[model samples]
Target: MRSFFDPRQLAHAPSREFHNGGWSAYAEVPARAEAILAAIGGTERPADHGETPIARVHAAAYLDYLKTAPARWLADGREGDVIGYTWPAVRRRPLRLDRIDALAGWYSIDAATPLTADSWTSAYWSVQSGLSALDAVLAGDRAAFALCRPPGHHAGADYCGGYCHLNTAAIVAQAARDGGVARVAILDIDYHHGNGTQDIFWTRGDVFYASIHADPATDYPFYWGHADEAGEGEGAGTTLNLPLAQGTTLAPFRAAQARALDAIAAFGVEIVVVSFGADTWEGDPISAFRLRTPDYAILAGDIAARGLPCVVLMEGGYAVSALGANVASFLDGF
Candidate 1:
């Protein structure tokens, strides 16, 4: 499998993230990409597809805020990392905000993702990595891997959260749709629910999304990801959420994976984009699943055996020591 990555993804390293009632060293770090790259062997920097592909999925206003918020915050003489302090409690969205501070809060969904000076550049390249992998698969490669940093499964079309600035998986899925794939299914196996991808394709039937993750009742993003959220309008029955209980084991995890795969197959999707995350491992610092290193191979083999062109995009994984082996094992099995 050809892997796409960019070392520049290390530029927007966040020092801290709000967790467990206080701030702690961010779980998402630059070392993540480094470890994955080391284990995965040679990788090519993604071709520069620019912001257009990202804009296909994310809102322009959100992109503008993400791109300029860090520089504007520093220019205003703020201290430490640029983090959102408050978020609107109601569902009524704010139309516009001119102040940088208010804009930060308006565009952000939580305090976990902090913007640094290089955030935009890093996020830009992350999107490029996913896009380039999509390009490779479209160009006839059976499978490709995109090692995206600042994992993107959490960020919504208009909000950034959980260390994700742009929804890279959604971007790739959207790019696949635009590239003439009639039905594209995104399989997000991240530990957390891909609420952002769900939100983006909530009303569209063309792109199907299936995520197997910790139930929202006990997970980080405390909303969405419920089994009943089976899409809205035209997308009804297209979005599938297989939410697992906390401390889930490999047996049930595989069962849930089988169900998700069955649903994707029923959808008759032409391509599958997997939002792969190693955080589901038992030793991961931030998640509660008990998938072992070998379990990843089982998962990857199942996906590969489906006989479909696949694009695996990196999502979240923080067990730094074993992260490399987990990623390498999955690709090797694939």
Candidate 2:
């Protein structure tokens, strides 16, 4: 597998996060992509160093905002990273809000996704990483991996949340379609349902998105992730949601993959994107799932057996010390 990455991933470190009742360091690490790729023994590639730039998919206005928002925030008297404070912009209304802060909330779906002065640069690089992995498979790589950090899967076309800034998995799948595949599938195995991904592809039938996560009723993003939500418009019946109960074990997770695999098969895809998150493991600090380390390799091998070009995009894993090991083992298995 090929690993795609950019150096800017190190820029968006959160000073603190809510963990175990109090705030601890946000686990987005600088060395993760490189270390995980090295442990997996894969070829390394600089992200988005070619003719096609990485910012193409994002809205031009939002792209401009990300580029300048931090400076603007600083100019507005904020001293630290600007957390998207409140979302004032609603799709149905146009002339109701005018403040930039309001626009920030409007554009940002939730408070969890904050922006450092360097956030745009970091998110841009993350997108580059995803695009690079997509390009690798498009360039005929049998399979590839994007060792991107600041895990995205939570960010949608217009909303960012859940510690995610750019919906990397969706970008990769979209890139694959742009690169030539007619039918593409995204199998998100993150502990959280890929709300942004699901939302982005909810109305597009050409791309199928399936997620296995802790049920939203009992998990984060409680508003979405219900099995009954299915898909809308052309995407009806195209999206599959397998929301497992909390404390689900490895066997059940493995069993759940069958449903996802069935969805992938039904899509008749030539390319696949796997949103990989170690949070599902028993050791994760923020989650309650019970997957063990050994289960990772089996997961990798199982996905590898699908016989399509696959790109595994890193999502979330907060067990800092063991994080690299779990991810390394998965790629080694892949």
Candidate 3:
């Protein structure tokens, strides 16, 4: 498989992660991309396709905020990284707040993702990595891998959160549609549900979003991701969520994969973009699941058996030591 990445992805180094009622070393770090690249060699740099592709899924104002938020914070005399302190309880119309402090809360969905000076550069490259991989897959490759850092799948059209600034996988999926793909499916096997991806295509039937993750009744991104959130309006019956209980083993995981794959097959999608997250491993700190390292290969093989062209993009996987091996096993099996 051709792996796509940009070395500049390391620039979005976040320092703090809010967990267990206090601040800790951010689990989403630059070493993640480093380890994955080391395990899966021969990574290629992505082409420079500017904000056009990103705007297909994200809002222009949101992109502008990501690009300039750090400078705005610095100008405001903030000494540290820019983080969101609050969010509106009700969904309201845009206020177009120019203040950096208010805009931070306005654009950020949660407190976990902080913006550094180079975050925009890193996130821009992450989007390019996805587009490059998508181009390779559309050009006739069976599959391609995008090692995106500051892992996406969490950010929505108007907000950033969960260590994700831009929804790279969603951008690629939308780009596939723009590139003439009639039907596309996004399969997110992350430990946490891809709430942002679902939000992006919540009302569109052309792109189906399915996720297999820890049940949201007791997991991160505490809202959304329920089995009943089938899709809205024209997109009804297209979105599927297969949430598993804590400490779930491979047997149930594979069973859920079977359902997700069957739905994709039934949808008759031309291609699939997998939000592959290795955090399901037992040792992962932020997630709870009992999947073993070899189980990743088995799970990936199941997806491969569907025989659809795939654009595999990286997502959350915090067990740094075993993350490389797990990711390598999935790609090798695929």
Mark the regions of model 2 whose C-alpha exceeds 4 Å error after superposition: 17-24, 31-38, 41-43, 49-56, 88-90, 95-98
Q: 1-334 in candidate 3: lDDT tens per residue?
A: 9999999999988788677688999899999888998899889999998889998888989888988999889999996789877788876786868889899998887888999999999999999999999999999999999999978999999899899999998999999999999999999999999989999999999999999999999998989799899998989988999999999999999999999999999999999999999999999989999999999999999999889999999999998998999999999888
Give the per-residue lDDT digits (tens) of candidate 1, residues 127-161. 99999999999999999999999789888998998
Supply the TM-score for candidate 3: 0.99
Q: Write the per-residue lDDT of candidate 2 for residues 1-334, one digit (tens) a residue.
A: 6787777777787665444455566556565555565566644556554323434345555666666777877888877666665555447765454455865776676655667777777776777787878787788887778777778898877667788777778777777777678999999898988888899889999998989999998888787788987899999988999999999998899899887997799789898988999889897877889998888999888888878888888898877667778887788776
Best-fitting candidate, scored by lDDT: 3
Give the poorly placed runs of model 3, Cα more than 4 Å off: none
Write out the backbone clash pairs for model 1. Answer: none
TM-score of the candidate numbered 2? 0.92
Between candidates 2 and 3, the one scoring higher on TM-score is: 3
Ranking by lDDT: 3, 1, 2
The local distance difference test score of model 2 is 0.78
TM-scores for all predictions: 0.98, 0.92, 0.99
Cand. 3 Cα-lDDT: 0.92
Candidate 2 at residue 118, lDDT? 74
